[model samples]
Target chain A: MNRKGKLWIIILLDIVLGLVFFKALIGASEELSWVYIEKGGIRPDDILSYLDRKDYGTVAIMARSYRIGSKVRDEDEELYLMGEYADLLFYERIFAEDGQTEEAADFEKRRGEIRGVIPEYESVLDDMDQGIEKGLHGVTSDE
Target chain B: MKCPNCGAEVELLDEVCPYCGAVNKESAAHRAEMKHYKERSKNAKEKACGIISENVALIVSSVVLVLLVIGIVAATYVEKNAFMFSHWAARSESLQKSAEYAGILRQYLDSGDYAAFLAFENAHVIPAYEEGYTEFEKISGMATNYVAAMNSIENVVLFGEGAKHYSVDTDISSCQRSIANFFYTYERALTDMEGDPHYGKLLDMKGKMDVALRIYLGLDEEKREEYLESSEGRQKAYLEEVLALE
Candidate 1:
């Protein structure tokens, strides 16, 4: 075969390999990204006031098994995290009052960002809670 | 014939087999009974754990029942024990003073002042010298319960379910409860210190008493017998020592 033929064969192999690697990377990233609901870190004061004022996250779902509000344990950090996020969002009023176009745009943007992050973080809630049942079996966990 | 050494057909006259030396089969069933024994061992351990849990449950229930009886019949008991109280109170008070000093000695353990604990023992309080002997007798009794409770707790730990059912499985907690009770009684002993003419000494006594009370309260009895035994412990020797300190 001519040199051109060999070069073309090499290029074809590289293209195939590149596509395979890209697909694998996407598959792995998607698994991690969608694992849990994510709420960013809480501000201590925001949480304190929320706790003080008796504001809480509306009943939410956890671990595919529990209903967020009444069924799950009150002390679960996942619920607490959600409650804090909700309080901040409620306190700040992400949605505008007057229905102005400019205010609504900012509200929509903020809402979109929070919506994007949520499922990735809170996943740890059920994992930590059920970790022992899953045979994490840490020394004191049974106690 | 096929040659064993090489897996090739050989002439009838060839002496050596060319292929691998294959051993004859050994049966796959060896140690089957050993496995049964192992399973039985595991079952036995679990049974033992169940027995431990029941024992712990009985002990805890009995203690609670006794306390309930005491609370209910407290008035009658007080009437009967009244004459004993004056004598006991005097003793209780003396023990409390000793405990107060011991409280300071315990602090010195954490502060890394072995000398402080040692020094406080021999120091002459205006009224008495409750020093080393009384303190030693008191602690030795606490240590006995601390050890016994700890041993009993080990059995409970074997019963994983029991630990979950009884939050007070650890010996440390029993000791801690004793210490807390000890502190209360210790505080009562300080009634004598109130009559001291020196304001500074009275204030100092007050501070020590408060600190002692707080320490007793904060002790994680699940872990510390010394703290729990500070009050009223199950041991008679400890009680005797505490009675002397008062």
Candidate 2:
């Protein structure tokens, strides 16, 4: 065709490519912003608050949320696993205390599974076990 | 060139031969036609150039504006669906693992471990709205509130345990607010669980939650029943009285 016709076609193609590129940039930005918000909002103090209260269920949820919501670093892997361990430990106590033998056994089995995977946390697990045991005492107290 | 009149050679644009001085009418007409074509070609080129030069700014501006608008639309679309797109990969993976995940969820539910079910579901980023998982929608909905209520109740119980060292007034007020929030979320959970096929299973879980509340908050069955039956104001009063005892 003519030079002008070819130029118009090139312009159209440029616009099309630009649009695709712009959309991709926006998608990346959106993903980044989301990651930033999630990662930034996860405060160690928040998890500590629940832990101080022996609310292992809430702590587990928070920790899991953080682990899933962001890219977990190698350093944080043990922390996340411990959170899961705490949750399992909490439910084990609850079920055992409530006289639900099968459910409590299930929790114990799950805890054993975790312990098998991360044997390095054995001491930490022991400490959590004792803490939750002591903490649950107050929960079951008549007073 | 040859002249047509006498077969004598002539200049290419010559209208007549000098030797014979013939009219050379054909040569003259050929030159006129060539001139006409040359003028037409030149005029066409000039006209195209003129048009482009005149509208160059307008064309550039129009294209830029179009691209700008498209960029805005693209940005807006991506921003609006960011959450969906971000979860899209995980959701697809969850769909592929639907059967396995469903089994795990079933175990949690069967065991009346709603909190663990929720934690597991969230961690895996399961698509609760998918066809295979729709059954969990109501459960998930109610469990969300149930978990929240449990969290708040735990906080109040912690205050009672002296794990937190806030002032008495602050502790009492905070505990009252926590109790109110627990009731509010519990009512919401009840609404969500209404008409669920797993209503019996859910009620059993709710019973366990109530037991937790009773054990930790000193809320006996009679007190709970009274609180549930009371008006909003009376419920507040009862919570205040309960906290006063604490």
lDDT of each: 0.35, 0.64
The DockQ of predicted model 2 stands at 0.12
Predicted chain B of candidate 1, TM-score versus the true chain B: 0.20
Q: lDDT tens digits, residues A1-143, model 1?
A: 85456545655555555555455555544332222121111223443443333222221111111211112333444444444333223212211221223533643464345445556654332332232122111121113
Model 2 ranges off by over 4 Å: A1-58, A64-71, A112-127, A137-143, B1-84, B91-103, B123-130, B154-195, B220-246
Per-residue lDDT tens digits for candidate 1, residues B126-186, read 1233443343443332223332332222211211111122233233344334445444444
Q: DockQ, in order, for the candidates?
A: 0.01, 0.12
lDDT of 2 at A36: 39
Provide candidate 2's TM-score on chain A: 0.52
TM of each candidate vs. truth: 0.16, 0.54
Report lDDT (Cα) of residue A98, candidate 1. 16
RMSD of each: 32.1, 10.9
Candidate 1 chain B — worst ten consecutive residues by lDDT sum? B154-163
Q: CA lDDT of B79 in candidate 2?
A: 67
Q: Quick one: best DockQ, which candidate? A: 2
Model number with the top TM-score: 2
Worst 10 residues of 2 chain A by lDDT: A134-143
